[model samples]
Target: MIIDLARFVEKERPYWQELEKALDEIRARLLDLSDLKQSRRVLGLFQRACSDLARVGQANAEPELRNYLETLVARGYSEIHSSQTYVRRFRPLHWFLRTLPRTFRRQMWAFNLSVALTLIGMLVGGILLVADPDGRQVALAPFPHVAHQTPSQRVADEETANNDKQKMLEERKSSFSAQLMANNIGVSIKAMAFGLTWGIGTALLLFYNGVILGAVCLDYMLDGQTVFLLGWLLPHGSFEIPAILIGGQAGFVLARALIGWGTRDGMRTRLRMIVPDLATLIGGVALMLVWAGIIEAFFSQYHAPVLPYWLKITFGSIELVILVAFYWYCGRKTGPEEEAEQ
Candidate 1:
């Protein structure tokens, strides 16, 4: 090893510099080493540098060379592995705005599957309601408020319940919002937690929710209250529905860990892998439901004049568009930027 210390240093310098650059890029958020290729390459570079450092030490090489190698190898180890789990003080704002979106994109397959299943459930519910009028009773049974009355009847009652309405709104909005948040969050948690059943329970719960949603919409549409239904549901449903679906996404993620189809990792390893993702998804869902619950209690409950259908519908549409943009584009790095990191 001591025979050609100068040549060894020259040969290893490029690799050490490359590893340092990769570390810098990661710190700058330009690259992600969660990818197999990047991790492998980085790990290779780190190991090589470590070997070089050991050889330098054995040969009693220059102190500066040994120290440089030591530092480079340590930084490589930290950055390469840190891609999976950042070790720092918790920053709520950064985690919510950045980490959460990146995690969602990383696990998009589960979310897309969740959406597809819910859509199928909605289609099935709509068809069942149209084919057999007798099934209407069973379909809407879960929501007695809608099940017991025609859409027109409920609309008229809500629009005309003007006796001390402001007083009632002032009194009930806070508590109502709280109740809605608690109930919706409970449902979402159950959706995620039920993944312990190998995703079957999560799927069933999502399907049931989709069925209820579809049935309620069809009931209102058939009864000629489409505007009223949109005014009431869209404002909150836009956020609430997607939030619930994300909960289901988290559940499927849990289920995937249990199944471990593609990866060769063991059960504990697989489970550990998705644990952070589950936490992120569930946390994001909680934030969404908080907004949804507020809208549902204050704005969605009031009919035209107090809160016009057009305004509520427009507001909800805007929220939906922003939400779609958030999940689709937020925290995403461009191909070139990511390449530069590598």
Candidate 2:
């Protein structure tokens, strides 16, 4: 049964034209990969062309037909590969400035949940400290080293504890940023790691930290040191708090990947899909912690003579607003390309 090659070619020519049109549209940016409908259409066309190319090969097709199909397939391959290459090249920058915030916005539900746990812990700790008298001990128990002292006393005790004031000052001056950054990074790592325990570890860690923060606030308020504490917290916490929340969000994402929710793929396959997002979140958290460490070490700790407490709070507030605005609007475009295609 000899097939009519000329008749088959005539029938398939329209399909080849369609494949070429899809490729051209993609290359010209007329078709957006971000739009699911358009992407599926383009993908389907590519797959169909691949199958046609195989069929043409099997048919001992004319040299002209074979060459055309090969060229079409190559063009499609290049378009796909080049787009991926572009993404790989720009991923770090794109993820940081645009994808991170977009992802953060998407995961606000989880972030809010984490914040709720923290706030609840803070509320409980504050209540215990003010109402129970022994609440200080209970609230501080989570932080073993600081458990012996209230927040109001901790700063003064640290300053006076060392008889070698000069040596203490030297040590702090050299290692302050490093120490603060290490601690913050450690917390983020813990949050992400403990997320594997079905987010229980992450929640508990956040709650515990919140309790400590609340106890400190309560102690300071009771001692009429509210101004001092605000000066201490506001400068670095504006960034640190958000970073911690993002960390918890990463943990939650990991838990979802583990639980096999919203995906039919295997655990490892699902994990691969989300690894890039996790990296972006953790990377942004790292940058925030670095900024926080700088503020905590150099700016927040300076005293009234060098920098007034009110001035510190004012500047910190300004910085906080700038960071918030950056996340809210950065990398977001308002063009037709941004819209989802029907």
On lDDT, the leading prediction is 1
Per-residue lDDT value at 65 in model 1:
85
Residues 11-46 of candidate 2 have per-residue lDDT tens digits of 877877887888888777676676788777777877
Report the alpha-carbon TM-score of model 1 versus the true structure.
Answer: 0.73
Q: Encode model 1's per-residue lDDT on 35-137: one tens digit a residue.
A: 7898788789888988888898899988998888888878887776564435444779867777789889899999998898888788777877788876677
Evaluate all candidate structures by whole-model CA lDDT and list the values in order: 0.87, 0.79
**TM-scores, in order shown?**
0.73, 0.67
All candidates: CA RMSD (Å): 9.2, 8.0
